[model samples]
Target: MRQGLGTQLRHLIDLLDGAVSAAYDEAGIDYRPRYTPVMRALEGGQPHTVSQIAEAAGITQPAATQTVALMIKEGLLESSPGVRDARQKVVRLSARGRDLLPQLHLCWQATRAAADSLDGDLPYPLSEALAAAIAALQHQPFGARIRKARAAITKETS
Candidate 1:
């Protein structure tokens, strides 16, 4: 039972990833898997510091910095000059990033539809049971974090 649950969870994640990737490709967007964190952070609030982005993304500062720098170079994000401390910069999405929101929304809708379709294939009781299990699992601490991150993605699309 435990193994089956684990497999189901893993497969769910795989399905979501594949759906999102396919949607992104269909939208003619250059998708960077790492961008999800930054986008989520931006959705949570504006002008996130490098540390903030790192924390939300669950990545090291160096990785966040590298990712942020790349985004900046791509004109997806811009850094505001530090007011209190000259060394600290606040980062926000640029015009390009704003323009991409609609495409991202489409991607999310497609993914959700795919999930719904997949769910519909299962027999009634199994589908209901599987959903309940998944929901219960999501209420756990680790699962909570995943849910929060997923919420952030939804926020970004809005």
Candidate 2:
């Protein structure tokens, strides 16, 4: 049952990712969906340091730094000297990035609508259910124990 659930979850996630990729390609945006969460965090009218972005995006510092570097290179993000720590650069969306917000919204909306249509008459309750599931899973007790057990089983089977 666990394996079946995992497989279904993987399929759904992959399909969603593919949809996002197709939407971005159709919109002529050379960006990745992995960057969306971080970008949306910055779009909340807050300049964030690399560490802050890492925390907010639930990614490692180095991962955030690499993504930020790519965004900077693409002219989607810029950094300025930090207020207290001159060494830490604060990052925010560039003018061009801010301008792309509307287009991004439209593209995402269109993609979401298409996906929903494919699934037949859709409602909003799935989002709430998904959020609850994520919260429950993230806070689940014995998570490490379950993971260790799975690893042990995999090792033994292999």
Candidate 1 residues 22-123, lDDT tens each?
A: 768777898775677787677644788899899987778999999999999988899987778878988988888877777776776676676678768867
Checking candidate 2 for backbone clashes, the offending pairs are none
| After superposition, candidate 2 runs with Cα above 4 Å error | 1-7, 55-63, 112-126, 145-158
Give the Cα-based TM-score of candidate 2 against the true structure. Answer: 0.69
Scanning candidate 1 in windows of ten residues, the lowest lDDT window is 122-131
Candidate 1 TM-score to native: 0.57
Q: Which candidate ranks first by lDDT, i.e. highest?
A: 2
The local distance difference test score of each candidate is 0.79, 0.83
Residue pairs whose backbone atoms clash in candidate 1? none
lDDT tens readout by residue for model 2, 67-87:
999999999899999999899
Q: Which ten residues in a row have the lowest lDDT in candidate 2?
A: 118-127
